[model samples]
Target chain A: MIELNHVTKTYPGASQPAVDSVSLTIPEGEICVFIGPSGCGKTTLMRLTNRLIPITSGSISVDGKDIMGLDPIELRRHIGYAIQQVGLFPHMTVRDNIATVPKLLGWARTKIDARVDELLTLVNLEPGTFRDRYPRQLSGGQAQRVGVARAMAADPPIMLMDEPFGAIDPINREVLQDEFLRIQDKLKKTIIFVTHDINEAIKMGQRIALLKEGRLIQTGLPDELLNRPADEFVKSFVGADRVLKRLNLLKVRDAMMTNPVHCRSEDSSEKVLEQMVKNDLAFLIVTDRDQRLLGYVNQYDLRGHKGHAGDVARKLTLTVSPERNLKEALSQMLSYDLGILVVVGEDGRIQGVLNSTTLCSLVGSTYDEHGGHWGRITAAGRIL
Target chain B: MTTYDFIVRNWPELMSLAWQHTVFVSIALAIAIATGVPLGVYLTFNRRLADTVLYLAGIMMTVPSVALFGLMIPVLSVFGHGIGTVPAVIALVLYSQLPILRSTYAAIRSVDPAIIEAGLGIGMTRAQVLFKVQIPMSLGVIFSGVRVAVVMSIGIGAIAAYIGAGGLGQYIFNGITQTYDAMINAGAVAVSAMAILADFMFGRLERTLVSKGLRRD
Candidate 1:
């Protein structure tokens, strides 16, 4: 665990401290994001943890040892760091860049080589194709991935990332974020992430610490900050549409209806229609005997059909994964003009159903708890 | 006689003079590189001092090579080495300092700060960052400076014969006194040839020494 007790840094001759008296603890295997507008000391706070910038006052301890007491060079080796510019050495190839920390720690040549290739693969870059290439040859997203790989080269227990994906375009940013989250799931390093983008903080941070003018305004889970902002500053910073932003934090599994009414494709249409009517469902999901999704039938298709439901069921063109965020599921529904989406597991088995009404109610319940009239109005409009 | 004919007739004499001239310039260059490159690197950590030292080096370049050689005679005579290889070499070394030092300073300073920051952030000591990142990145530019120094030294070393250093410049002085056009032509042609050859060879050396990753194409 990393702990900062009453940290304050006032650069020489500066009137205001870059980081005011702030205290925070980051537990092992969790990601805590520091977010605020530019010049809010989020970046400064992260730099102080690694001793990149000296702390004017207060103390920062990583893994229970004070940073100032440790040799700065040796301390930095065990703490991974990545930044927005990537800052890759143009003179080194991708392999050498990732092997920087390992080489510094004096690892064996063979071990360093194997570790370099392993990290390249972990970041989703093929070692064979990328290991020999220079940083200038890579696109922005590819460079950022290599930056992350290099930071994790020594497998340090702590990592400090300053807007690591801030330079990529929107589409690639989302892709990189998802890829990083997937990697983080397995590695579980205690990470201090700094960014100005709230959406990124919500997506990546397990706990979000909001800073303003070198002071932390609020610290809590993404949902807490969105649903119950600390003050008007946080409410405005998270934006007025925080209720919608909450959808980005929640997943299809969190809001999806489980055990949705379904039937065997080989069942008679009359029986399928009876099941749909009994469950008050407009459509019936058709599955094979093995529980693998085949297709789905609506009441309109079954009303006039006199054969097996499998013969008349339209192809299920749209489906969502239970692991996806609700915002994505909602977008897919809107894009396809779909009222509901079948949530499927990796094995192609139907897991749940996410419809407009379920999403509206899920958002609506939160509003009811907060007594938010605006949220209720918005949720009602979305349902219709 | 034509320049080519004079060169052929005195090929052995010409080769010996060229060899002596090469040695004279090589010694001076070795000393300059050893001292100047490090001095340049040192100056990078102190900007105010760098400006002063670079300005002084630039002023040294503006002095005429012959006049500088003339000044070295008086200075070296105190050590009983006036008007020969020692004084001639001292002048050439001083002349060679600007290019080598200036290039090393500029190239190393211009290395992307972000790259150095990353190097340090990833746990490299200051010395390691200098050797592994800064120096390698600066190699291409520093080499070009050395190439300039080599070519310039060859041209200036011919004039060193005036101080009795004994090189290709001997032919020029002797030919002028004896009014022998063939001897003068031979010396001038050899000097130019040596300079061109040094430049071409250093270009190839630069390609090999600098990392392939730094190459734009």
Candidate 2:
């Protein structure tokens, strides 16, 4: 565990402390994100942990030892550090870069080589293809991966990252965030991550510590901060789309209605119409014998049809998978004017259906889960 | 006599003078590199001192080679080693300083601050970062500077013959005194060949020394 007790940092000749008297504990095997706007001391806090910048007052203890007493060089070698710019040594090949810490520790050549290959593979790069290549040869995303690999080269138990994916484009950023989360699930290394992006904090951090002007505003799970922001600054910082962002963390299956009203492809049109009316539905999904979604038929499409629903069923080319986030499902529904989206499993079998109402209700309950104002949302739900 | 006939008749003397010229330039360049590189590296950490030192070196470079040589003769005369190799060498070393020093300083400064931070962040000591990271990356630029100094030194060493320091410059100065054009051409051709040869060799050395990732060609 890393604990900071009333830590403060004031640069030379500076009136205001960059990091104020902030006290926090980052439990081992958990990712604690420091998130705030520019000049909020989020980066300064991480630098303080590694003693990159000396603290003006208070104490920091890493793994139960006062870090101030420890040699900064020795402390840093044992803690992984990655940053926004990546800061890769351009003159060194990818392999040598990853082997930096190990080589610094005087690891044998063969051991360093093996560690390099293992780290490259861990970051999902083909060691054979990328090991000899320089940082300049790698793409932005690839270089970020290598930066991650280099940080983990010595398998340090605590990793400090400051917007490691901040420089990447959005699409690649999401991919890398997911990839990093997947790796973290297995490594379970204690991490202190810093970023200005709340969305990224929500997606990547298990717990977030929000700061403004060097003061710790609040520290809790992403939902806690979202549902109950400490102040107006946080609420505005999270933005007006806070509910929409909450939906991003929720999966399609979480909000999807299983055992939805669906009709077999060969079901008679009259029988489907009766089922739809009984269930107060305007349309029914038509599927094949294996429960694979073929299409759907609305009341208008069924009018004057004398055969089975499949005969008049329009192909629902747009479908969502159960693994997709609710935000993606909602956007698809909105873009396609879809009232409900058929959720397909990996095997192409219909698992459930997602409607906007159900998704909204799911998002509403999240407020309730975090002890926020759920009554207002419930009233809104009823009005909707 | 024709230039070719003069070369054949006095080939032994020409070879000896050329050897002396090589010796003078080699010693001056060696001393210049030894002194200039350290000074440059030191100055990188002290900007105020760097400005004064670099300015002095730049001013030294603007002094005409012949005039600097004349200045050195008088200065060395006080030390009782006047009008020979000592004055010539002192002039060459001073002349070579600006390029060597400037190149070293620029190369070291050109290294990315991010790379240095990464090095420090990853637990490299200051010395480790300097030797293992900064110096290696800046070597290509430093070598280019060394190449410039060497070529320039060879040309200037020929002029040192005026102060009675023996070299290919003796033929040029001697020929001018004797009003012999062939002798002057022979000396000029040999000096130019030596300079070109030094440049080519250093170019190859740079390619071998600099990391492949940093090489543009």
The interface RMSD for candidate 1 is 0.8
Q: Pick the candidate with the highest lDDT.
A: 1
TM-score, per-candidate, Cα-based: 0.89, 0.89
Q: Can you give the DockQ of every candidate in the order shown?
A: 0.69, 0.68
CAPRI quality band, candidate 2 = medium
TM-score of chain A of 1: 0.83
Per-residue accuracy of model 2 over A140-228 as CA lDDT, tens digit each? 99999999999999999999998999999999998999899989999999999999999999999889999999899999999777778
Instruction: Please report how far candidate 2 places residue A214 from its true position, in Å.
Output: 1.8
Residue-by-residue lDDT tens digits, candidate 2, B37-144 = 988888899999999999999999899888988887777888898799988988999989999999999999989887888888989999999998999899998998
Model 1 spans > 4 angstroms off: A257-319, A341-353, A364-384
In terms of lDDT, the poorest run of 10 residues in model 1 chain B is B112-121
